[model samples]
Target: MNIAVSIAIPDDEEKQTELSFDELSDRAKEKARDNYRQNYPDDGWWDSSYEDFDKIADMMGICIATKQVPLMNGKNKSVPAIYFSGFWCQGDGACFEGNWYPEKDPLASLTKVMGHAPNDADLHEIAFGLAHLSERCNQLIPEARVKVEHNSRYYHSNSVSYDIDLPMPIHIQEGNELQHMVFDGLRTKLDLDDEAFETEVSDLLRRFMDWMYGLLEEEHEHLTSDEVIDQYLEEMKFDEDGEAIY
Candidate 1:
C-alpha cells in the first residue's frame, strides 16, 4: 500500500508581516487627527486660548465678571465669564456681559493687537465709535454706569444688550435756571440725548462682540489646523493597524 500527500505554501513576498513603516506612520497620523477631532469636535478646545482674549478685554477697559472654582489645592480661583459659540453657522458667535470703563487710549490698545491700519471700514468705525463713546461718557456722564448683558438664547453679536444709566448732573438736580441752561447746551453740543446715547452704546457693544468673535474664530482655526494637530500628536503612539496605543 502507498499514500500520496500534497502541500501548498504561500509565497513569502505576497505575505505581509507588518505594514510598511511609512504607511504605518501615515495611518497613525491620520488616526491621531481623528482622535483629536473626536475629543474636540467644536469649541471644547479653546480653554487654553481664552486667556489671551480675557487679557485683551481687560486692556480695552472691560472688566469681565469672574466665577470662583475650587482647585485641587482646596483653594478657589477666579475665571472670566466669557461666553462664545463658533466660527460657522448663522447663530454661532461670541458675546460677553461685563462692565466697560474709559481707558487711557482704548483704540491704541486695540490697534496694537488687531492691527494699526485696519482695511475693514466696519472695524475702523467700531474703533472710533467706542473711543468717542468712552471719552464722552467719561467727561459728561461721570456718574453714569453701564452694564452689558446677553439677552438672547443665541450667541450672535446682536444678542448682547446694554443698560446705561445716566444720572442727572448735580447742578441740574438743584433746579437753577442758569445751570439747567448750561447743562442743556452742553448735552446738545455733545449729542448726548437719551436716544442717541443708547444707540451709540448699543452699537459699540455689538461691534465689540463681533470683534471678540473674530478673535475666537481665528484662535479656533489655528488650534484645529493640521499643523497644530501634528504638533499635538508628536507624543502619540500607534499599533501596526493604525489603532492608537495608550
Candidate 2:
C-alpha cells in the first residue's frame, strides 16, 4: 500500500512531464493562499488578526487532508485511512503522530492483531510504508512532518509491571529545518539510568527505499474489506509453536 499519486500544478504540463514533490508543495502553498482569498474577499481579509502566526499555522494545517479513494464500487463506500498524519508550523511548534495499521485501524499493529512475533520483513514493510507517507506529506507541507514512530514496550513481573516509551525509525531532514528542537525532544524519551536500543537513521531510510523499489517491480492487488480476514483469524487457534492448530 505504499502508493503515491502525482499532483499537478496548473499550466506546467508542457514543460514538466511529472511534478516533483517540491513542486507539489509549492502548489499546495498557492492553494492555501487562494483559499484564504476566497474565504475573505473584502478588505477585512487584511485585518491585524490575520497577522498572528499561530492562527495562520492552524489555518494552513487545516487546509491539507489525505487524498481519499473509494474502496468499493458503490457510493459512500470509500474510507480513508492515514498511515501517518501530523501537522505543525513555526509558531505552533510540532506535533506529529504516525502509526502503521495491519488493516483499517491505525491503532492496531500487525503483531497485536495477528498475535505473533514481528519478523524483520514485517517491521521493514511497516516502517517503509510510514516513511513514504511521511515523505508524501512533508513535500506537500514542509512543516507537516513525522520524524518518529512512537510505541511502548511493557516489562512485567509477578507483582508489578512498567511501561517504557520506545522509538522506531526516525528520519532527519538535512535542510529546510523547522521546529527541530521541539521535534527532537518529542522523538525519544530518555532517563538518566535507562537503557535503550537505537536504530541507525541511515539504515532505516535505506530499508525504506529498498522496499519502495521492490513495490515498483511487483503488481499490486486490489484489496477488499478485511472483515473476512478478521473472521478467519477469530476462528483460528494457535499452538505453542505459533502454528495454527485449528
Candidate 3:
C-alpha cells in the first residue's frame, strides 16, 4: 500500500504520506503520477509474459543456423528491449549458428548487440517492475554505479559499470522496492483488501500497454540501442534469455 517515485531518472523513494497528491502540482505531480504508473500499473504490467528468445536473438542478429537454442519452448519475462545490444561475429560463424559460448566466443568487432542482466538473477521474471533492482544496486548506489548490477555478463570483470554513478538523495531512497518493503512492513498487507483493490490495479495497468508494445516493437527494430548492450553481454557469451548461449 505504499507508493513511490524517483526524480533521479533511474531511481525513487517516498517523502511522506501526509503530502497529498494535490499538494504537488506541475512537474512534481506529473512526475509522481509517472512514477506511480511505472511501478504499479492498472493491469499489473509486471505480469508474466511470453519471451520470444529466438526472435530476440534474430533481432540482435545472433547466429541462428542451428535454430535450436537451449530454449525450445520459448523463454519468459524478457527484459525491456531498451536493455540490450549485439556482438560481432567470428570467421567460424558460431555465434550465428547458435553454437558459441559466452565465455569463449570471438566477437570483438561485431555491431549487433543484445541486452543482458549484469548477472543471471535477471533471467527469471520476478513479478517484473524492477523487483531486485535495488538489492543488486545497494553496494554500488553509494558510489554512483547502477549499471554494473544489470550487466549480468561478468562475475567480477572490471567493467565500465563501476565508472557510472547512481547517487540518489536519501529522500528518494524510499522509492526503491527494498527500502519501501522495509519501510512499509510488507508481511501484513495483502489479505481481505484484495477484492476492493483488484479492479483499480487492473485499470491502472491498461495505461502502460501502449508503452510495453512500443518497447517490444523498438527491440525488434532492425537497428537499436540493444545492439550495443548485447555487444557488451557478448564478453560473456550471454544470450537473449540471459543464458549462456553455448
lDDT of each: 0.69, 0.30, 0.29
Clashes of each: 0, 0, 45
Estimate, for each residue in 42-106, the C-alpha lDDT of model 3 and write its tens digit. Answer: 33222222144334333322222322223346754333222222222221100111211111121
Write candidate 2's Cα lDDT for 1-246 as tens digits.
899999877784454233322233444434433433333334332223222312222222211122345435654432211122111222211111222211222223233422332454644354444444334333322232213332322111111112323322256455525655544444433211113212332233334323322332221111112332333334444333323334
How many clashes would you count in candidate 1?
Answer: 0
Question: Among all windows of ten consecutive residues in candidate 3, which has the lowest summed lDDT?
Answer: 92-101
Highest TM-score model number = 1
TM-score list, all predictions:
0.72, 0.19, 0.17
lDDT string, candidate 1, 1-246, tens digits? 798888777796565444332446666667667777677635335556466656756655677777676877999877776677766687888877788776566557567535643565665666667667767766676666668887888887788777778777665667587877877677778877678877777777777778778867887778778887766555655566655554
Model 1: weakest 10-residue lDDT segment is: 15-24
The order by descending lDDT is 1, 2, 3
Cα displacement (angstroms), candidate 1, residue 66, comes to 1.4
- Most lDDT-accurate candidate: 1
Give candidate 3 misplaced runs (Cα > 4 Å): 1-24, 37-53, 56-246
Cα-based lDDT at residue 52, candidate 1: 60
